[model samples]
Target: MCVAADWRRLYWWVVLQWVVGVATSGPCAQRCDCSPKLPLVDCSSQQLSAVPEGVPDATQVLNLTYNHLKTLSSRQFFSLRQLRELDLSANMLTVIEVEAFVGLQNLITLRLSRNRLKIIPVGAFSGLPNVQFLDISENEILVLLDDMFGEMPSLQKLEASENDLVFISNRAFSGLPNLLELRLERCNLTTVPSEAFSRLTGLQHLRFCRLGLTALPNNSFRQLQRLQDLHVSRCPWLHTLAVNSLIGLNLTSLTLSHCNLSAVPYAPLHHLVYLRYLDLSYNPITTVLSGLLGDLLRLQELHLVSTGLLHVESGAFRNLAFFRLLNVSDNRLVTLEESAFHAVGSLEVLRLDGNPLACDCRLLWVMRRRLRLRFAGHAPSCVSPVQVQGRMFQDFAESEVARTFTCRQARILTRKPQDVRSDEGHTVLFFCAADGDPAPSIIWLNPKRSVLTASGRIRVLPNGTLEVRYAQVQDSGYYLCIASNAAGNDSISVSLRVRGFPASSRNRSGSFFLDGWSFASGQTAVNGSQPFPFDVKTLVIAVTMGFLSFLSSVALCFIFMFFWSQSKGQIKHTATIQFVPRSSASTTAGRSTVETGRFTMKLI
Candidate 1:
């Protein structure tokens, strides 16, 4: 009896421990939140297939990210009324039925990024009135219908970047009137319509980076009064900006990078008086005008790199007084003007490298005078030739301090009379030359310039001379030649004439060979047209034919002699055998015959 009681007690204790161990192991069912402490429910990275049920009603934060959940039905998440932060990022969610989040009224932070959602049905967030932060980035969202976010009244931050959004319809974002930060960066937004963001009155940050935007409407960003930061970077095709396109925006940091702008427009950037950071790098801007940087009073950092800027107009940058970090590297500038760095009194850490600098007296003066105080030790070195084609720029030492280094324009080789028209088969002779530092190319004006050449008859001589043996009537108009060097172009034209057949017929000879008549003045006419006569060619052909005929006769005579000698003995033997055969046949039949050796018939 004692042993049985002890065993019962031990068994009860073991059973209680097993029950407690399973209760604290994990979530009790699907979509259940079993965070370690503080009513925090984290079901992320569990590879959950279904929306887990049995989540604690007191759950404050629910994390369902990094899962393979396909769809979010309306009733799946209805129990989590107390949930505030919901993370469903990095999932395989393809479709979200309308009103999926209709009951989550207390949700504030909602993340659905990096999913496979192609389209967002209307009223997907209809019940989430208190939602402030919403991220739907990195989805296949190509189009946004109007009033898409109409239900989220309190939504402040919206990140819709890195999707395939080609265009946004007007009033698509109008429902989010209280939104503060709107990010459309890295989306395939090619064109932003003028009224796309018309109703977002409270917007402060608008980011559009790595987008395929080519052109923005004239007043696309004009209405955003409270916009502070406008990020437009890594857009290679945004080559032009209309005046006042960005006028009204109170931007603090503006980035316009890797664009091919060659000149700063006359547009007004002064409207953005609170601007702090401005980046305009990797462009083709070659010149800087006066008062260009004067408008950015509160600017801090300015980057102008690889801008193809070779010239700085006098006192171009003498007005930017408040800039801090100035980066002007990777340009084609040969010299820095005296007052270029005299401006920007608060500037610090200026970088100038990878530029084609002319390190002459003018450059040395800038180094000695203002460089130690402004540029420090980050000045670039010269990249051009000290001695080009055997001439040294340093040899002109006297003019070094005042010499101006200007970029010589490339002289283009062009075909003169560029617009050429003629009847087919018209021959033309073209000439090409140049009138600049480098030679130019001259050529014919076809789809591509092609030279007129004929084998053995047409020849291009070593000295650029073209010669033709006989000009045909088809070869009547123009021929082209292309000559070029590094400079610009000049072209010449040569007119060609080809004799045509007329109504009356004549011969090639001076005297009409066909009619056996000699005309006066040594005139030669063919088909009623007078052409140049060549007697030497005719004489040469006639002499060659006579010599060939004589050789042919001698060959025939030698062939006859060789055959006559081979047949002489055969002829004699054939005659002797003819007589012997007849005599032998008669003797066999008992008839005799005699053969005579000689007979004299000349006596008669």
Candidate 2:
């Protein structure tokens, strides 16, 4: 009877343990929330140290965001084989054991962003065969090793932005054959090797913004044949682009703004014929040379804002037949040549504000052509000629332009004296004033007819004043002031005479003059003598006087010929003759006698 009672008590204890196990494993655990209707689990922000265990096996979506989960063991999701989406974002996950996602064969999307993961071990995602989207952004990932995602062949999009990724192996993305978009913004990568994207032929979009890269090799994207959009912005030190950097890709839109480039790399850009949108803003490119963008036949929009551009060559947009939008604002352009926009006849939107534009006749073509340009309410202002400054280009009148913006010929407005006197070792200035349509260039020719350049003691002021500091006896000769422009050229002459010493005593240097009329002693002067110089100013004056005298003589000759011809035509003719007749007496004696007297005529 005692043995029977012991067997009975042991049997009852075993039955009670089975009942507790069955109750705890039904659809939910102590901290996790489960829904049997939709087969979903929500264990987020639970402050749990590990994944709750009693989640339903039929759960297709798992939400574990904002949790204190520290590790992902290999059997963490072993029961959720039908899990299609998993969210572990904003967690303290530091380690993911191998085969951590082995049973989730139907998983399509995984979010591990804002985690403490520094490395992804091989085969970490080996079981998720159909995973299409993976986001590991804002993590501490240091490097991307080869075959890191080799198990997920169906992965279409991957975002690993804002990480500490400094190196990516050549075959890091080798198995991702269907990836369409990859974003690696704000990474610590210094360079993207030539074979970094070797086999991503189906990739349609790629971005590498704010990376620590300095250059891009020619073959960086040689294997991305179907790439449509590429963004490489905010890379402050990225300046170099090889000749064939974008040769093989069929890109439709490319952005390289704020990369600190000094010039537009036209050689590599010429290969992208199918490009439609291009942005090269916030660079230091100075000039847009002709044919630089002529090969992009189908190009539609171009952005060159704040690029420090000063000039645009005439044929810069020759081949952009379908171009619709052009932005060249915030540049240093003063004027666009007459043919600068000749090629973009189909342009619809044009942004030209924030520039120091000279609104003269050169820009009248835009108004006359009646281009349907959409300025977006911000018009460019003129910055030249004082009268037209601060005026808009569209406000210029066509009828008044010829009278107001006429190309005037350069002429001398102020002339220096025929002869100037200066003491030895003194300063002398010769003045010349000129006026023209386009500002004329002022040049000074010395007595030797050689062009004078600014030197130690010789300087040309902005207003065409030649200042000779410490003038010596050898500087005593005719200096010419020549002002020239596209319209014409004018010149004036001034003879400089150093008074105080003869030619032989010039080198003695006893007492010299410091000012034009004062004398000083014991002062050192430039000790040299110029050769016997040719006075071009004197020759010019002589030729001009001769020409005027010849003109005067020709006028006199013409006046004399005119008067002689008038005198010949104005001769008056007068006939003074008296006619005497003696026929009356013959009438009375008709039969007797008839006499006629001879008449004498005097002409005066």
Candidate 3:
């Protein structure tokens, strides 16, 4: 009997709620369309000047976009308790009064983009507690004050792009604790506000575009530990990035495109072990050195478009094991070599059409994988070796590859360096020049078979000239110069004889010797005995061997003295022997007939 009474009361309660909703909902406003089922109001794209009156009390979605509303007075939409979305974009909104969005407790999406609003009062969005996505882009806002958002605790994404933002208060986003993404692109940021961004701990994607800074200081985004993607584009003045700028973050995607960087910021990106997508397009970087990108072991997709890259050195991508896509289009590259990569077996997409490729043996790796690479948009073509010029890489037959894509070994252009004689204090020079299909790099090796770099007394010039400042006796030796390219290498050896006094053994590495032999003449004869060039490694080894010899001699002398003293009766010596009786194997030794003696001896 009690269960039947409860069912009857529930049915009557539903009828009472329906009666109240019908009695309270008013008729639709003039010049607007309204739906009674979902309760949506469309007052958008019209010449309505103010908020439409007589709107139904049960409306949930309101559209006021593309209108001529100039101001929003207080309590404009206070009665729309069920409102969830509000769009006022593409309007001429100049001012919004306080509590303009009051009583919008369930509002979630708000769009006020492309407006003429110069300032937004504090309480303009006071009652929007559940708004998650807010877009106020393309406005004339100059600054963001503290508490401007008015505590939208459920907000996650906020995009304020294309604003003339001149200043941003440190606490401007303090009320948005759950913000997952924030965009302030196309603003005039003098410097990255690292202190202000520390408050956004939950931010996953951060975009602070168009900075007037030359360099990002160390640990610039270290506080954004949860950040996954960071983009800084259209920053022409951002040329330098500190090695530790992206030190502590675990970003997966990074875009530093459309900047004025002269080279890749490899050091700053070396620690981004989790980075998979990288875009570094439209920079002025020229060449990438061999093995410099070895640290990016997990990179999958890479973009180096329009970077004015001329050469990709050998073994440059040797460490990228699972590489997929590479877009180096619109560069000045001559050709790419097969030796530059260790393995790109999983590569799916490639974009290398805009480069002036020679299509020679250096680029045979691309030809073999042309069908599998799936060239994006356009395929690579030959720009040199007139026989195959203007031909696509995919069109060449496998049998003609060797005949067409040929390599020209590097050949020395200038004559070998002459043997020069210098005095005790002088300088020496050796020059080497070469020519090849692709350019060759120069390297110098000393008499000790070690590669020469800029050191205390020796220097390597950019134009392949070896300069030795102080011509000491130890600097006299034969030097070898090697010019290498992708095809082959050529080398030549030269001799240097420095005449000096035996006692003039001072190292003046800090000061240069100005009085040197003229490099513009033939070899000169020296009148002194040639002394061996004192190589640093050779000297250390010789000294170590001599010390070992001295130690062995001292130890032998001690041993001899100890034996001689004993032979001359100056020291006492004792020797004792004893014999013991052996027992039977059965261990039945019940009695022993002879006394036993035992003796022990050691050979040294």
Q: Pick the candidate with the highest TM-score.
A: 3
Identify the runs in model 1 with alpha carbons over 4 angstroms from their true place.
1-33, 268-271, 341-344, 358-604
Q: State the lDDT of candidate 1 residue by residue for 120-205, as single tens digits.
A: 97878788998888899999998888889988878888899888887787878867878888888888777765587768888888
Write one digit per residue (lDDT tens) for candidate 2, span 150-205: 99998888999999998888888878998888999998988885576876778899
Candidate 2, residue 482: CA error in Å? 14
Question: Which ten contiguous residues of candidate 2 have the minimum total lDDT?
Answer: 525-534
Candidate 3: where are CA atoms >4 Å away?
1-26, 35-38, 412-436, 452-472, 501-604
Across residues 1-604, which tens digit of lDDT does each residue of candidate 3 receive?
2223433654564366455553336788887787654457889887888878887877766798888989999988888897777889999999989888889898878889999987787767888888888899999998887888856888888989888887888878878788889999988777777877887888899887876667788978888999999998889988899989988899899999889999888899989888899999998989888887788888888899999999888898888887888889989988877677767687888888889888777887777777788888698888987888899888899899878887778877778557999875567888888888677888888777778875546767888888877576767889888998778999888889987744334333222322332443453222221222344455568999999999999999999987887688644344467765565223336853665666766533
How large is the C-alpha RMSD of every model relative to the true structure? 21.0, 31.3, 21.7
Q: Worst lDDT window (10 residues) for model 1? A: 571-580
Q: lDDT of all the models against the reference?
A: 0.65, 0.78, 0.80
TM-score of each: 0.56, 0.62, 0.74
